[model samples]
Each structure stands twice: as structure tokens, then as C-alpha cells.
Target: MYETYTTVIGTVVSDPRHRQTSTGEPVISFRVACNSRRIDKRTQEWIDGPTLYLTVSCWRRLLTGVSQAVAKGRPVIAHGQIKTNEYVTADGERRADLEMTATAVGLDLSRCVVSFEGAPGREPSVAGTTTRPVGSEVEGAGADAQTPTAA
Candidate 1:
């Protein structure tokens, strides 16, 4: 009936795992670590706070881009619906995993500089076709047209 959405800004903690589902749909999953920080008002010094870790999953067409773009230790922003995976351990302890089925993910530009590169294997579009390559510049396609550059 309701869904919870979250946006996480953090460093990628693990390399993206790319695989196809049993039905042959592409998917990519990765972990991220977000830590809290605060500046003490009186001392005016920044201090580290607790860290929260979460797993992010991207599906379908988003998989290729996510797999190629994300890597361990890189800062990224991920947004998606939050889901809780609950289970019981062998020793009878209850545990939960925080995961997000990511609708979008990208580099955290505020923390680092990054260059945009077009997705590989994209096909060029022809006239009257609605599909275009990930980063192709179409002549006379209007102001939104973007020329892909080498990173």
C-alpha cells in the first residue's frame, strides 16, 4: 500500500556484482557505506558519527551503466525504495539486511570530480527512430543534443 524511498550518499564499499537473472534479465548489486558527521558548535570541529551500510541493486538497462561506473571506494549517490530482508541465523539469532532496489545511482560530484563517458555498445539512431545511443549528439536535434567526449 505504501513504499519507503531513500537517497544514500556514501562511498561504494564493494565492487559491483553484475549477473543475469534466471529469466535472463541483467542486474547489478553493490554495497555502500554512509557515515554521519557533525560539527561541534562550541569547538567548531568536525566529528565522525556512526556509519550505516546498505546494499543497492540496479536492474535491467540500468545494470550496464551501474556496473561500469561504480567501483569500490568511489563516492556515489543512490536512490531507491528501501526493503528489509529478515532472517534467522544458524545460532537462532534474528538479523536484518537493509537493501535498496535502486532506481538511480551516480557519482557524488560534490566529493570528487568525474568525467562522463558514453555507454559502450550503444547503437547509433537513424532518422524517425526514437531510440538514441546513451550519449550521442544528433545534428539539429535541438538544444538538448549533447556531444560525447572521451574521458
Candidate 2:
């Protein structure tokens, strides 16, 4: 089976919701809104573009950290398998929503600062040396649970 993957860079529009799947697996879900803004030379003002909103779901290991790190209006970058969820509404109208089951979600560093905190009992990397490939900590704590302090 083919799966579609996408990365979204945007602001979290809602608080993360912690819920369980029918099978009792923990899942964290939130909404992200992506938009662009540019300064107009003529008016010397900012011009905002249309916004795209997608519901993002984090599962298993991803649940703990995301539930702690993000809140409404926080910037984040989420990458995952993309799908369109279609269902009938209570009003008897059919609706479709864009959703992503996130494989990874993190703060948008370009918009805010981040401080790295290793999980307990993990050794720190030696200066001027690499212990592992960047992003190899997927199996460990991906978001580090601790809220980042902006500089």
C-alpha cells in the first residue's frame, strides 16, 4: 500500500487533545494553521496569504512530548502520512478534513529558540565529535517533553 507523506510548518491553533484509540492506545491530536506573510513594498505593510489548516495526530511514543510541548498558537513543524478524513456531519452534510498521523513533530526553530535536554541516564556527546547521526533519536525522546525556553 502507498502512503502519502507531508511536512507542515505552522502554528498550533488549538490545545493538544489526549485521547485513546478504540484499542486503548494513547493518541494526541491538535490543529495546525499554515500561512505566509510578506511585507508589501508599496504599502510598507505586511500582506497575509490564505491559511491551510490540518489536524495532526501523534501516537504511541509521540503522545507524551507533544502533549506537553505545544499549546494554542505555538509554532511547530509536523511531518507524517497525509490523509483526507471524510464523514457525515450531525447536520446531515458530508465534510472532509485534512489530517496527518505524525511520525515526527517539533518546534519551528526558525520562529523560536530551543534548548536540548537529553533523557535521563543518556551520555552527552563529546565536544567536536558525533555519537550518532542527527535525528537518530526517534526511538528516544523526540520532543524532550520539557517545554523549551525561548532566548
Candidate 3:
């Protein structure tokens, strides 16, 4: 059988819930709401379209980074395997939930600006020369060595 993969770009609708599995593995879950907007040809105005709510789950090493970087109302992009959860309630109604085991979660650059802080064990590249830790001043570059502020 072929597995399905998908990418979702949306606003974080809920705070990330981080927890440890029974085996001591870290995990995080969060909700995202994706809404479509279109321009009306007649009025030349933008109108809101339908919205899709999806649950995103991050596991292991990905969990900690996602939990720290994402927050409620923040725009994010998630991509991974897709799964549909089905369940029945006491009322005898069946409902389906769209979920993804996110392999990657990142801020949606189109919506907002972001500063890239170097991760641990990773080398920071400045002008393709020397490697330095995040927030360290680069030698030889006078005033331009400063970190650029996000607009």
C-alpha cells in the first residue's frame, strides 16, 4: 500500500501540548487552522473561504523544537504522513479527525519575520568563512557583523 503525505500551512490554533511517552520518548501535539482567502473579481476585495482544522503530532527530537518555536496564533507550516481517525460517540454519531505525524514544522515566512537561532551541535555559517555560536560577534566585519533585525 502507498502511504499518503501532505503539507499544511496554517495558524496554530492551540498551544502545543508536550508530554513523555510511557517509554520516556517526548511528544507534542497541536492544532492548526487553515483558511483560504480569495479576491473577488467584481469588487476587487478579498474574501474568506472555508477553513480546515488539523491536528499535528510531533515525536522524539522534533517535539522539543516544535513546542518551543510554535505558539497559539502563530503561522506555521507542517508536512508529514496523513492519517484519519474515526470514532463513535455515545450518541451513536460517527466523526472523523484529520491528523498528521509531522516530520517538519517551521514558521510560515510569508506571514511573519523570524530570526534563526543556531541549534546546538550545529555550526553557524557567516559569509561562508568561520563558524561561530549564535549571538557571537564576527571578527573583521565592523558594523555589519551585527545580527539583522527582522522587519
Candidate 4:
């Protein structure tokens, strides 16, 4: 079997909708919008490229993490297998949508600061942890926030 995999960096455009299938398996789905920007050499100005919207689905084990970490308006990075779904609207309009079955999804740290969450059913602590200021944070970021560096 052949599958197309891709990574998308974008903002979560809707709240994740979660439900259990008839067979009792858990699943979650959400929408993401990716807007790109580039600098044009001719005018020396930034240009906004067309935005790509996609629906993302995650199954079973991924549901918990996504439920805890993902939400509307949050920046997220999703890696998954992609497919194009074509359909006809009620008014006889044709449409195509990009959909992905995610293998991995997480916060986009480049755009925001976040606290490390403890695993499900566990207490969060910073015992014996090392931390350092991230020099790449946007100017005017709060002084007290710092990302954990891998040991």
C-alpha cells in the first residue's frame, strides 16, 4: 500500500472534536490553517501567500495528548499521511479538501511559550531539572518563561 506523508505547521482553527466510534475506539479531528509569507525581491516587501486548510484526524493513543495540548487558536505542528477528499455540495458545487491522518502532533514552540505537562495521572515537577533562557524568543516575551532544554 502507498501513502503520502506530510508535515504541516499552522494554527488550530477549530476546537478538536472527540468521539468514540461505534466499536468503542476513540478518535479526534480538527482543522488547521497554514498561511505562508515570503519576501519579494522586486518590491523588498513581505507577501502573504495563499493559505492551505486541512482537516486532521488522530486515533486512539493520540487522543489524550491532543485533548490536553491542542485547542483552537494554538499553533501546532502535525505530521501525517495526506489525502485529497473530493465531494459535491448540496447546491451541486464541487469541492476538494485536504485531509490527514496524523502520526504525530504537538505545539509549535517557535510561536509560543508553554509549560511541560506531566503524563496522564502523574504529578508535574521540576526536580533535578536544568533550564536556560531561549535567545530566539520574540522580543518583549515575558522574562520569567523558559523552555526546558533536553539533558
Instruction: Specify the highest-lDDT model's number.
Output: 4
Error of 2 at 116 (Å): 4.3
Per candidate, the number of residue pairs that clash is 0, 0, 0, 0
**Each model's TM-score, in the order given?**
0.72, 0.75, 0.74, 0.74
Error of 3 at 24 (Å): 4.2
Model 2: per-residue lDDT, tens digit, 24-114? 9888899999999999999999999999999999998777667656667767899999999999999999999999999999877667645
Q: Root-mean-square deviation of each candidate, in angstroms?
A: 8.7, 9.0, 7.4, 6.5
Q: Record all residue pairs in model 1 with backbone atoms less than 3 Å apart, i.e. clashing.
A: none
List lDDT for all candidates, in order: 0.75, 0.76, 0.76, 0.80
lDDT of 4: 0.80
Report the poorest 10 consecutive residues by lDDT, candidate 2.
125-134
Error of 3 at 51 (Å): 0.3
The TM-score of candidate 2 is 0.75
User: What lDDT tens digits, residue by residue, belong to model 1 across residues 1-151?
Assistant: 4699999999889888888889988888999999999999999999989999999999976665676667787778999999899999999999999999999998776765444434468753222112223344466766434443212
The residue ranges of model 4 lying beyond 4 angstroms of the native Cα positions read 117-151
Off by over 4 Å in 1: 117-151
Which candidate, 2 or 4, would have the higher lDDT against the true structure?
A: 4
Residue 65, candidate 4: alpha-carbon lDDT? 76
**Which runs in model 3 stand beyond 4 Å of their true positions?**
22-24, 119-151
lDDT of 4 by residue, 1-151 (tens): 6799999999899889988889998899999999999999999999989999999999966776777677788788999999999999999999999999999998787776566534668864333222332344545646444454421
Query: lDDT, candidate 2, residue 76?
Result: 88
